[model samples]
Target: MMDASVDFSKEMEALTKDLVGIRSVNGTAGEREVAEFILRWLRSFPYFTTHPERAFAQEIPGDGLGRENVFAYVHGTKEAGTGPRKTLVWHGHIDTVGTEDFGALEPWANDPDALLEKLLAEPDLPDAVREDLATGDWMPGRGACDMKSGDAVFLVLLTYLSEHTDAFSGTIVLSLNCVEENEHTGILHGLDVLDELKEREGLEYLFAINNDYICPLYDGDPHRYLYAGAVGKLLPCVYIHGCETHVGQCFEGFDASVAAAEVVRRINYNTALCDGYRGEYTLPPSVLKLADLKPAYNVQTAQEAWTYFNYFVHAASVADILAVLKGIVKDSMDEIAGRIDAEAEKYAKLAQQPVVPPNFQPEVMSYDELVAAVREKRAAAEAKETALDDELAAMAHKLRAKGRDLREISLAIVRELVRELHPTRPLAILFFAAPYCPANTLRQEVAGEKKLYDQLESLVSSFGEETGEQYKILQFFPSLSDSSYLKIDDTPESVATLYQNLPGGKTVSPVPTERIRSLSIPAVDFGCYGKDAHKWTERMYKPYTFGVLPKLILKAVAEFL
Candidate 1:
């Protein structure tokens, strides 16, 4: 049994401070150090030392910075005749955003006490924010709330389970991943490793509970949520090609940057594309990356420009998202064409020269169409070149093997194939980029879906009914999360078709559709409540996050497991 005399608050606070002090900033040198620290800490436990196979670390390499996903599990003692025990996965990310402009407080980065005092005493801090900090109810640090606090919560749960092995009927599996803020590579690697553990141990996962941080809905009152699904993310990059002209005759040619700007203005923060409403929640589209293609400083107008959007969706299909984006491009193009025609008329009237035919309305082409056109043109000249067909087939095969999206490879192939085939240099084209997370929702009318939903919902609602706590079933997590990999749909073939018909469909890869379909599992986000995550003043509300949330999660685990 767990030691009842132990002060849970102090223990959790110490663990959170230790984790936050490690400075496991993604893409930095400290990530490996933090992973090593976690491994060492896990090993220090007597249970882990006696059964070392129960806990270990798996290294996942990123762009330049490699990371590690730590895992620990405790199996149940129920008899073999009763069937296998269900697993409750507790997932948390260890990586945090970089610390920028820490100012004089940089010295206290490793000392939460000093940092907390500094933050509370800072003159520039807001009165409301400062008052909250002054109450000593918040732990202020870069990753303190965003969410090493959640990690500490899971650690405490694991520790308690180790002492009281019979407290639950099933197993408790914990996964601490990295790179969630940027690439989500950590979760990808963690899931694969988790599968290996499950197969090795002959365990069945009942649910994956991710402890990611959630922002409050109001200032004083924290609106607690139970996310039934994660929002899907898409990065759509558009390349605009324009005719370059000298500054003396700039009005005669279209500027690619201008077109790029118009596209940004049209799509950035446009709520029309946010049609993936489930219940009362929806995540609108926003801008993540935007840039214009310009070679060195010169007097000539730019010929090419590119921009990528941070498009998010839930419950919306690929075709719908594409159609909306295409409409935006068409509108921007028409407006730009009209503006250029009016400018040409003015220039012609002032200079007494014949009006330059305002024939610069660009045609928008999808990445697949562009690549196919290039391939057709190539095959016409050389009848024996079967490389393009082989390449596309190979891409599909690789996607099946890798379980990654096809956007990056497709973008590379399309850029290579179509760069030389652009007869119309001044046209706009849209392509998908790297990193695609498919959205998933639990709301379904199908019998199989409903059965699974009822099983989990019944378990969750029992706790509410017993405690008389009214819990709102949130539509979407409203953020990109690894839980997307856990969802499966009945119409998988249709889903695959939609994916293949997206803007860069030819290059898009299978999204673990097969795995999710075969082993579809329900996931929930029971993360800590916090304010200002990914910001300098990030902090977690101690009372609810540390005290109440764990008990609530424990209730679900007890009922389901």
Candidate 2:
């Protein structure tokens, strides 16, 4: 048996610092180095053996740099009278999002000594210290929350099991992959190699636990949650066509950027056909962009102009829903193009003009099941909300004001629920588009549709659980419309700050006071970094781990293999 005196805090701090010290920034060629470090660490353990030639060095497109994936395994002892039941796989990715300061790897600014000092100096350090200031309740650092901490946690658990081998019930395998932040190519490659190993050994795996974002001890909860579903992503690029002309010219024709803006406006406003969930299908636009390319002097020149627009569609949507969205775009484009043509003809009567045509293409997620999973999650969230209010009121007492405490408590419960719910969403989406015009300004007078902000409000209001509770829809744009437009910077630090700020005057639902007793962990401010893996926009939460990890682990252990 292991010593109870062993300080897990010291070990965790050291491991965190060591991990942060390694520069495994994505798009950099340092993955091999970091992989080797992990290999060495795992090899030092007597219970684990590195898989020969299983460490793969791969070069990705565009970056022209080599990355690596590492694998290892440990045999499980058979029961006194029964053969080994099955093999369990624990997977983690070793790559991190890139930052301008690639050299930040040396001498982690957030070190153990620093953390210990802070922890000990705190006025109220509970006997069972469950939170880290550096990360608050969430995992901190570049890859800390993403999967590196997961790697460390896996190692810690394995090491503990090794010392107390009798505690484990089955065989376990460790798979550390690279390039998850890129295209998950390393994972695909690793799986292929595993297949080859299985063929050679005539063995099969019964269960796989992806420690991608596993938080073992976030909250004090004792439940372990297992994930059996995954959501896919769909990124489609929409292009608009218009006319370009000199700024001084009396251009009466369409501007490509302006036309694209109208398209976005319509997308944000028109909701009669798009609002509410249809069957198991739901559609929400994740990101929208409007871009322009032209000479500074000839911005108004009567030449073909174009701009690209991107959208992140949820995986739960059906083919029919996508077709409907496309049809909407098509109709909008036709109207815009017609107006531009008429304006061009009118301008031609007085001066010279050019022709423009609207164009768009669709890029979909590779898997359909992913879409289904996301839809199911939305349905579950709705159901949970329906049941939450009554549950909260039951726990409230005379000392606390029912409404105020209930709101706070409900908000906390919902926050926890969202964390559990988000992982069920798709990983990412890819979009494809092409240019079709210069000044894509297709402005024809069409009846204005209800804005998206209003539609979202209606959807939230339909919950009808409480009143005076505010709701706001936050829109993320990849690029700025102009200097005044807010741009989403996908860095962890920036995301953390944004989550803390809740800018754009948006109001989030508050937690109900009565439901606070049900929380696995105390509520803290947190941010989300969904499955936008390869967009260089991946983020880590600084406070989620303390409040969410333990509950998730306990749930997984109790309910799932």
Candidate 3:
């Protein structure tokens, strides 16, 4: 696929390094800077300058950081008897995760040349990392593997396509998105751009190629792989409120932390609660955040406690997941209820007086129930002035204006609700939070979907055979991506699970569920081969990722077109 005159390997290497040199950590100024640089690179070509409208930046609304998604499309002139042009979307995330993991090398993290030298000389380095450095087959730095290298692939391909537009008979759309490390804010907003573009240009969507990275599961894992679909993710947060009483009257009030701890104990790393599809099982849910809601330390047992877990969605529906979570909460409450009464009884026997044990009863409910309770309470109060929904929306907007991240805003809204409703203590309230990504997998039963996927599998196999490299088409990508926005298997109505309950869902990077499902483009992730992505020792395999993968990508897209 590479032209003899063009130094394809050198082009890839230079482009990758140039992208990595910029410290575009997610949510930083560097993120926007990198996007601007991409814009300049695209418009640098005479072709783009002539057709400036073809390449432009799409601002992601409500980011609060002013980040943008860079888009450039090239049209192929292959004679095809069709009403609308066939289009292929090639997308990559340009923003990288943070550099705090770099430790003392932080100052040079973005300077790959200096970081490489520092890593090679560092003592107590892992044997594998040291060996890879010695071989000089790896390019080490933050974001080098996770995806700036992949962005380089998209940039070069877009350039190649722009130059050779007449050789193929389809359109190619290159999307460089931001904020994949956190909320996937960039691609979520970019979904709007794609929908409008498809309608205005009358282009038929085919599929997307996500140029993320592929790392081994274990040492020396030799197979190169691609993903036909990606797993979904949801953050189910549990907030608990407890009765407050002085230390002298220990049995009079129970601590909310007890129930919170129980929730974590029952849910964290519990494989029985995991979701499975075909033979693929998602990693068990684990707590991403667990903390009390107190502003500061005090003598009184915590008034409220909060925790949230990372739940991967596979074959299970949202309702299926909520039922399991509700069951866990109920079981946790029952066990905690028993403990409270038993402990109170023990204390009474030890003290030996006319003592009255609190024997606090634990209560569990979903966020939806909490909202309903608040509404009922408002109706009883007969405030008659403000609608409950409108008031909550205003409050959420005020919080966003203060610059709190979506997670904090989410918790804050719940806290306000708790205060207004004054829910009974030893209480657990469960709800979804911002940045919910629904899980998606291709349904081969759909018309033409099977043929498209089979064609992709064959292309991967041929590439592997030609290069004498092993490749496997995995069921799930085993990582999070913006690809979730490409196609959705769930009904559009199913979106209410998050929007109706997640605090500030409308403002904090809401998933464009209907738009995504309507687009419904099949997606395949062919990533740059690398190891230890998001780790300090992250490295990309220069020979294959830079030299060979470009040809493979070109061949696959050309075959599809």
Instruction: Compare the candidates by lDDT and give the number of the best one.
Output: 3
Per-residue accuracy of model 2 over 450-556 as CA lDDT, tens digit each = 23234323443432223232222222112111100001112334223222221110122221211211211100101122222222222233323322332233222
Model 2 regions lying over 4 Å from their true place: 1-9, 49-63, 80-85, 100-140, 162-170, 214-228, 243-254, 268-283, 293-297, 300-318, 338-561
Candidate 1 Cα errors over 4 Å, as ranges: 1-7, 61-66, 78-81, 220-222, 383-386, 389-414, 446-470, 488-513
lDDT against the true structure, each candidate: 0.72, 0.39, 0.82
List, residue by residue over 1-561, the lDDT tens digit for candidate 1: 334334467777888889988888887767777888888888788889998988888888423565678899886554242555688888888888877757677777556788988887788988878988888888788888878898898888787777667666678889888777776777766667767767777678876787788776666553566777677777777777777789898777788888888999988877766664535545566776566556478888877777787777666666666677877887887778778888888879998998875667677776666767877888777766677656656755565356554444554455555565765646777776656676776766657655656765675576567655445557568777777767644256546535544443433433556666555656778788788877677788887677767777766766666
User: In model 3, where do residues sit more than 4 Å from their true spots?
Assistant: 1-7, 62-65, 380-386
Residues 448-542, candidate 3: write the lDDT tens digits.
77787788888988888988988888767888988887988766555776676687777764677778878998778899989888888898888
Ranking by TM-score: 3, 1, 2
Return the clash pairs for model 3, or none: 232-439
Top of the candidates by TM-score: 3
What is the clash tally of candidate 3? Answer: 1
Instruction: List per-candidate RMSD values in Å.
Output: 3.9, 21.8, 2.0
